[model samples]
Target chain A: MTENDILEAAKQAVVAADEEKAIEVARQAVALGLDPLRVINEGFTPGMRQVGDLFERGTMFLPEVIIASEAMVAAVAILEENLPAEQKEKQAGIAVLGTIEGDVHDIGKGIVATLMRVYGFKVHDLGRDVPLQRFVDEAKSSGAQLVGSSALMTTTMVGQKQLEKLLKEAGIREQVKTMVGGAVVTQYWADKIGADAYAENAQEAVAKALELVEG
Target chain B: MTSYPTRMGDGHAVEMSTDELRCDILAGTEDAADRGRIPALSQEEQDYLLDLFSYPGKIVGVQPGNEVVLTDDGSVNALYGAQSSSGVGVPLSRELAIRVYERAFCMDTMEVGHPDYSFKPVKPIVSLEQQCLESVLSSTIIPIYYGAMPNLALYAKPDGPFGNPADLLPQGKISEARAAQEEAAQALTRDMVYVGRKMAEVGADGFNFDTTASAGDAEFMATLQAVEELAKTTELSIEVGMAAEFVLGMHGQVTYDGVRLAGLYPHEQLKLVEKAGAHLFGPVVNTNTRRSSAWNVSRAVTFVKACSEAASIPIHANVGIGVGGVPMCETPPTSMVTRASVAMVEIARVDGL
Candidate 1:
C-alpha cells in the first residue's frame, strides 16, 4: 500500500477510536519506512483535531473523546518507539494537570492531559482529588511552566483558590502559569482566584495551555 | 402538518414539523449517547418519544384542571441567591431565607440549603437547619424540608473520617478503595439520619436528599440505606433528587437491594429510589450545551418519560439550570426553559418540577 494510504488509515483509526486499527496503521507506516513524526502530526494529530471539533460542536460526547484519545495515544506510542532519538519532535513545554482536592472528576482532566501530550507538552497528570500542595511540589520538582486544576463541584472549587495561594506561598507563583477549569469553573472564577487562564473544556484547555506556554 | 414549538441549538425559538422533531429527537438522543458505547434508544422507544412530543402547541402545558406541585431544591436561595465572581452562592440567615421563600418567591413548599449552600455535609449544618426549622415551623404555613448533598468526597481527608479514593485508587491502591468507600458510606448514612430525625422533631414536613450519588455508586448506596433507615421511624416525606441522568460507578462494585447500583439510568434509579422508601424521586437529565432545547427536551423526555411511566411515587423532574432539557448556562433563557417545562409536563407527564 502507498504511504499516503497508510497515513490516511491512521487518521481514520483515531477518529473511529479503533485502537487495533491505529496499531495496524502504525505498523504499516513503519513497514513503508514513513517518518514516524509525520504519521503523528499529519495523520493522528489531525484526527484528534477533528475529534476536538466534533466534541465542541456537540456531535461527540466525553466517552467517545476519551476512547479516541486512547486510540491515538496507543498509536503514537507505537510510532514513538520506532523513531530515531534525533528525529523526535522537540517538547512543547512541561505542564502539570489535576482535579483539585475534594473533587473526584478526572474524565475532563484526563482528556486535557491526552490532548496536551499530543500537543507535545511533557505532562504530569496528578489525577483526581489531588492535594493543592502537590501542584506546587510538582511544579517545583519538574520545573513545569504550566499548571492546570479542575474542580467539578462548587464546594471543591474553593480548593483552586487555595492552590493559587499555595503556589504563591511556595514562591513559584510568579515563575509558573496556572489554568483553572471544570464544569462549573468560569473565567470570572479564574480571575478571582488569580489564575493565568480559564478553560471551559479539554479542547480549550489545550489551546490555553499552548497560549500560556508560548506567550 | 402540525408545527411544534422548540428552540434551535443557539437557543433561538423555532417551529418544526413532526418529522423534523422526530429526526431531531432521535439524532439528539444519539448525540447524548456515548457514541455507540451505551445503549441507543430503540426504534420503538423512539416512536414512544415522538408520540410524547406529537401534541400541537406553541408551548404545551398540563390541562387547565391538572396542575402539578412545584417543588425545588436550592429554592430558598432562588430569591436571595448571590452570585459571586467565584460562582459560590452567599449564605443567608434562616429568617431571611424564610422571608425569601414565602414573601418573595411565594413557594408552596419551602426548602433551604445549608447556610453554606446545599452541597455541604449535614453534620455541620444540622444546628443551622434546627435554628431555621424553629423559625420556619412557627412563622409560615409553607411546609419545609431540609436539603443537602451526599458529597462523599467531603467525608475524606481533612473533612470526615475516610481515605480519599481519589488518592488511593490512582496510586494502584485498589484494595483500599472498597474499605474507604464503605467507611465513607456509613458516615454519610449516619449524618443523614441524624439530621433527618432532628428536622422531623422540629416539625419539618420532610427531608430532601438533593444531588444524591454525585460522588458515585457508593454515595448512591449510602443514600438508599439512609432512606430505608429513616423510613422506619419518621413519617417525613423523603425526596431522592439525583445529580445526573445516569449513575457513575466510581466505586463500581457498590450495590443496593442485592442489585449493583453502578450504570443505572433514571428509570433504574427510580426503582431503587422506591425500594429504598423515598416518597418522591427527582430524576436528572443533563443537557447538551451545544444542542438545541428541542434536542435536549427530546433526549430528556426519552429518559423522564420512562421514569414517569415506572414511577409509583411523585416524579419531580429537575428541569432547572442544567438538567431536564434546560440549557446548561446560568440563567437559562426563559423561552427555552418554559418550552422545556411545558414539554416535560405534557409529554413526560411528570408530577412536578
Candidate 2:
C-alpha cells in the first residue's frame, strides 16, 4: 500500500478499536520506512481525536473510548521505539497527573492521563490516592509543565488546594501550570483553588493541556 | 416504554430508546429508537417538559403538581455543617457543630449521617453520632441514620489489605482483590454494626446504608452482612441505597444469602436488600455527563421502573445530581431535577425521591 493509504488504515484501526490492526499498521509503517512520529501524529493521534469527538457527541461511552485509547497506545508504543532521537525530543510538554489523597476514584483521571499521552505529552501518572507532597515532588523532579489533580469526592477535593499551596511552598508553583478535575470539581472550584484549568472530561483535558503548555 | 425526544449530555437533541435505555444511558446515545410517543403525557405536557431545556432557570420547580415523598441522605449537612462548602444556607445551629451529619428534618424523612460524613471506619465518630443522634430525631419526620462503605482502596495499603483499584484493575490482580475483599469486608461490617447499634440506642428511627457497594461486590456483601446483623441486634429499620446502576463485580466471587453479588441490576439488588431485612431500597442509576437530561431521565426511569415493579418494599429512587437522570453538574439544573423527579414519580412509580 502507498504511504497515505497505510496511514489512513492506521487511523481507521484506532477508530475501530482494533488493537491488533493498530499494531499491524504501526509495524507496516515502520517496515515501509515511514517516519514513526509522522505515523503517530498524522494517523493514530487523529483517530484518538475522532474518538474524543465521538464521545463528546454522545456516540461513544467510557468503555469504548478506553478501548480506542488502548488501541492507539499499543500502536504508539510500536512507533515510539522506531522514532529518531530528534523526533522523540519533539514532545508537546511534560505532565504529571493523579487522583488526590483519600480519593481512590481515578477512572476519570486515568482517562485524562491516557488522552494527554495520546496528545503527545510525556505524562507521569501518579495513580490514585496520591499524596499532596507527591505532586510537588514529581513536578519538581520531572520539570513538568502541567500538573493535574483529580478528586472525585468533595472531602478529598480540598487536597487540590493544598497541592497548589504545596507547589508554591516548594518554589515551583510559578514554573508549572495546575489543573484540577473530578466529578465534584467545577470551574468555580478551580478558580477558588487558584488552578490554571478545570477540565470536565478527558477531551477537554487534552484541549486545556495544549493551551497551558503552548498557548 | 416509549421513546422520548431528549437532549444528549452536550445539550444536543436526540430520541432516547424504548427498550435499550440502559445502553443509551451509558453511551449518551440511543441504539434502538422505537420512536413511540409518551402516551401518559399529552403533546402540551411533552412540550412543557422539553421547554425546560430551552428556557433554563436558576432553580426550577414542579408545576404545583401532585407531590411525592422525599427522603434525603446527608441533607442538613449540605446546609450549615462542614459539608456545606458552598456556604448557602441559614445561620449555623449549635446542634450542627460536627460537619458530616446531614440532619435535614424538612424532608418527609430526615437522613442523618454519622458525625464523620465520609463514613470512615474510625472509632471517635461513633461517640459523635451518639451525641448528635438525639437532637436529629423528630416525632414528625422519620429519622434515618445514613452511612457508606466506600471502596476498600480508600484505605491505604498494609493497614488495609487492598491497594488502589485504579492500579489493581489495570494490573488485573485477581488474588489481591480476593484477599482485599475478605479483609475489607470484615473491617467495614464491624464499623457499620458498631455505629448502627450506637445510633439505634440513641433512638434513630431507621438506618440508611447510603452508597453501599461502592467498592463493588465485596462492599455489597459487607453491607448486606451489616444490615442482617444490625436488623437482629437493634430494632432500627434498615434501608440500603446502592452506589451505582449495576454492581461492579470487583470481587466477582462475593455472595449474600447464596446468591452471587456481582453485576446485579437494580431489580436483583432489591431482592438482596429485602433478604438483608431492609425496609426500603434506593437504587442508583448513574447519569452520563455528556448525555442530555432527557436521555438521563429516560434511562434512569427505565431502571427504576423495573426495580420498583420487582420491589416488595418502598423504592426511594436516588434522583440526585449525576444519578437518577439528573444532570452531572455541581449544582444540577432545577428544571432537569424537577423533570427527573416528576418522571420517577409518574413513570417509575417510585415511593419517594
Candidate 3:
C-alpha cells in the first residue's frame, strides 16, 4: 500500500480511539518498508494535535482529549517499541510536571501531561497541590532536566516563584530548567520569577518544556 | 455543686453529686437503670467515657451529665461536632476514638504552606473561628452562608475584564461590602464555637461548618485541617468541609481570571488530607453556589468521585440541602437526615462505620 493509505488509517484509529487499530496500522506501516518516524510526524502526532485543538476550541471536552491521547500514545508506543537502538537515543528528555499547592484544578495540567507523554518525553507528574518543597524534592529525586509547575491561582502562583527559590537553595537550580504557565502566569511573570520558559496551553507547554530540557 | 440534687422525673428526689452519678455508672447501676436506649458501657467503658465526657475545667471540658456541650472554655465535650453528628454521641466508637487519639495529638496535620509566614492564616482568627464555629452548630443541620468577598473576576485586573461581563459591576468593586462581611463571618466562627459548644452540650446532635470565605483546596483545606485539628483537640467529633463557592471566601483571592490562574486545578482536594483522618469530602468548586441549579450538590458528589479516583482512596461526599430547593430545614427532620445519609452512603457506604 502507498504511504498515504497507512497514515490515513493511523489517523482514523485516533479519531475512533481504536488504539489497537492505530498500533496495528503503525506496525504494518513500519513493516511495509515505511519510515516509522515519518508515520509519527505525519500521522499520529497531527491527529492528536487536532484533538487538543478541538478541546481548546470547545468542540471537544476532557473525555475526548483523554480518548484521543490514549490512541495516540498506543500507536506511538508501538512505533517506539520497534525503533532501532540508535534512533531511540534521539527522543525527547524527561520533564516532571504538576500543579502547585492549594490549587487542585487539573484540566489544563492533565492536557499538558497527556500532550507531553504522547510526544516523546518520559513524564513524572506529581499531580496537584504540590508544595515548593515537593517540587524541589521531586525534581531531585526524578533527576529530571525540566520541571513544569502550572498554577491556577494568583495566591498559589506565588508558590511557583517560591519553587524556583527552593530549587536554587537545594543546589539543583542548574540541574533542572523550569517552565511556568496557567492563565495568570505570563512571560513577564516568568521572567520576574526566574523561570526559564512560558507557554499558553498544552501544545505550547510541550514545546516550551522541550526547549528548557534540550537547551 | 451537684447538677442533680433532685430527680425531676417520675422518680422521687434523689440527691447525688455529678461524681456520684459517674460512680453509679462506673458501678454498673447504669446498666439496669431506667432510661431511653443508651449504649451500655462496662467499667472500662465508663472510665473511657469520663476521660472525654467529664465536664469540669479543661478544654475537653464539660460537666459530667448525659447532656453534651460545645464550648471553648473547656466546659463540655466538643470537637468540631461533625463526628458526633449521628446524634448517637461519640460516633467514633470508643475503639476508634482511642485509636485516633493514640496516634493523633493534633500536630500531624502540619502547616505545610506559608513557609515565608508573610501570609500566615489570620489568627486569633482562631478565636474568630471559634465564634463562626458556634454560628454553624447552633442548628441541628448545617446552614449555608453566601460569601460576600472579592474574587479576581468580581474585581477587575488593572486593565482586564471585570466580573463575568465587563460591566456587571464597577471596576474592581464587584462586592464592595466584602471586608465588612468578612469581619462578620470572622466573628461568627469565634462566637459560634462558643455557642456551638453550648448547643452540643445541650444535645444538638452535630454541626456542619459552612463558610463563604473558604475558596481553593489549600485555603479551604488549611482552614479545614485546622478545624479538624481543633475538633480532635476538643473531643467534639464534628464534620466540617469548606463548601467552595468559585467567587469568594476569607482567603481574599485577587486573581480575577481563574482560567488564567495557575496552580489552581478543579480537583476534590479534601479527599487527599492523609493526616487529618477526619471524615470529609470537598474542594467542591465547579459550579457557582449562588447561581447554579439546586442539583449542584450532585456535581460536587461527582467531583469527589473524580478526586477519589485520582488519589485511589475511598471518600464519602455531601452537599448542603436547604430551602433553596425541595429539601428545607422545615421538612421532617428524618427527611433531611435521610437525604444526607443517602448521599453519603451512595459514595463510601461500607459495611463498617
Report, to 2 decimal places, the DockQ of model 1: 0.11
Q: How far is candidate 3 from the true structure (C-alpha RMSD, Å)?
A: 24.4
List model 1 lDDT by residue over A45-107, tens digit each: 888888887665434544455567778878888889888887655677999989888776664
Sorting all predicted structures by lDDT, with the top scorer first, yields 1, 2, 3
- Which portions of model 1 miss their true places by more than 4 Å? A1-83, A86-93, A98-180, A185-215, B1-23, B30-61, B82-92, B118-121
Q: Which digits, one per residue and each the tens of the lDDT, describe model 2 over residues B145-245?
A: 54544445445363454564444434334466467667877877887788788878888788788878766678889889888999888899888888877
Q: For model 3, how does the per-residue alpha-carbon lDDT over B1-353 read when each residue is reduced to its tens digit?
A: 84543221111234555575565434332321211122234355344433332334222211233221111111011121221111223444322332233345321111111111111132324344334334434421322121111122212222122212112111123243233323333433443345335434533333434331233221343333344544554544343333332222222332221221112222323333333443433333332212112122233333343444444323323333321111211111332233323332343231111
Q: What lDDT score is found at residue B104 in candidate 3? A: 52
| Residue pairs clashing, model 1 | none
Candidate 2 chain B has its poorest 10 consecutive residues by lDDT at B30-39
Off by over 4 Å in 3: A89-91, B1-353
Model 1, B1-353: lDDT tens per residue?
88866665334456788888788878866764553133456677567556555555444445686677778577665444533112235476656776666777766787766635433455666786787777877887777777877777778764657887655553335458668888989988888888888888887888899888877788999999999998888988999999887776556677898888766878889999999899999999877555666678878876787788889999999987767887655555666776678767776789988
Candidate closest to the true structure, highest lDDT: 1
DockQ of each: 0.11, 0.11, 0.01
Give a tens-digit lDDT track for model 2, residues A39-136. Answer: 88899888888988765533454345556777887888889888876765578899999998987676567667766866778989998879999998
TM-score of chain A of each: 0.75, 0.79, 0.86
